[model samples]
Target: MGKAMFEKEKVCFSFRLIDMGNGSQVIDESIKTPMDALTPELQAEYMEVHEQLAFMKTIQKNNRRETERGRKLVRNPLHRLACFCGLA
Candidate 1:
């Protein structure tokens, strides 16, 4: 009976926000819950919240990567001037 129920719902992904020394850390993890242990309605709510939180973290990660890339591509005026003088 227990095995049958788990096979139906499958495993879910969960995200947790942790506070570190400087900033917050987002952790993505696989969570296994026995759906039969909770009311069906509550199980549905939990899974919904889990997926939304994971999606939020993914968005944050992509934005941070884009910001870093933009910084690297910036032109340094001093370097450009030196190169123009053939000092480089």
Candidate 2:
């Protein structure tokens, strides 16, 4: 990972967390391996936005699938009319 180039208030923030695999959720020590410099706040914001976008994409995909299923379905005239209303 490339280091963060931007500096805030003349302070270059670098944060890294490592998991010890001891069934602990929180990381005790800082980054041992060299990683890209990134501010904790910036990384958190990036992750939050990334997760929100992923969730929105998932919802859109599901809605598209539902609409496609509605369109693909073929039945009697009454059923078709009912489904047409559902598509709207």
Candidate 3:
């Protein structure tokens, strides 16, 4: 990963791997982005953008759940109708 960073992003990042058990491992990574060196105003702006992205993700998740629930609702009647007609 460090080598890839040097080749692609041209930035130095460090990480370590910890073995859990049974061939499982976890990566503890630390990367310095340009945002880390931002000024106060820029940091605030970055945080605002981050918050907006989190909000959007949450909204998308709720929307997906609602859509799946709606699909189930729509299918339930058809399923019942099929069962009534001995087609199920």
Candidate 4:
């Protein structure tokens, strides 16, 4: 599955599954920022959250069969964030 988020004319974020050519797949994430648009503090915070998401993706990838707990834990935070942002 894939998803893309847009802001104005730009794609702010996206992710998709990529075939690695070795009978494996990987999740690829793309995060984009407008030049000089974000304040230093905001940029730092964004990167921190991005790192956390990356770590979570890694965990999910390493565990071939996702446990119910793992699935819920990974999804709940994102669901809450979406709801908080009025997107859910």
Write candidate 2's Cα lDDT for 15-38 as tens digits: 234446786433223423222354
Off by over 4 Å in 3: 1-35, 77-88
In model 2, state the lDDT of residue 30: 43
Which portions of model 4 miss their true places by more than 4 Å? 1-32, 65-88
Error at 80, model 4, angstroms: 43
As for TM-score, the candidate ahead, 1 or 2, is 1
lDDT of 3 by residue, 1-88 (tens): 5666667443322333356988975545563335445677856755665566579889999999999998896689888798789987
TM-score: model 2 vs. ground truth:
0.44
TM-score of each: 0.45, 0.44, 0.47, 0.36
The CA lDDT of each predicted structure is 0.64, 0.55, 0.64, 0.63
Using TM-score as the measure, the top candidate is 3
**Could you tell me which residue pairs clash in candidate 4?**
none
For candidate 1, lDDT tens digit of each residue in 1-88? Answer: 6778667554443433344887855444553445555577867766776788779889999999999876654466766687789976
Expressed as tens digits, the lDDT of each residue in 38-62 for candidate 4 is 6778557556656777898899877
Residue-level lDDT for 41 in candidate 4: 80
In model 1, where do residues sit more than 4 Å from their true spots?
Answer: 1-36, 75-88
Error of 3 at 65 (Å): 0.7
lDDT of 1 at 57: 83
Tell me the spans in candidate 2 whose CA falls farther than 4 Å from its real position: 1-37, 74-88
Better of 1 and 4 by lDDT: 1
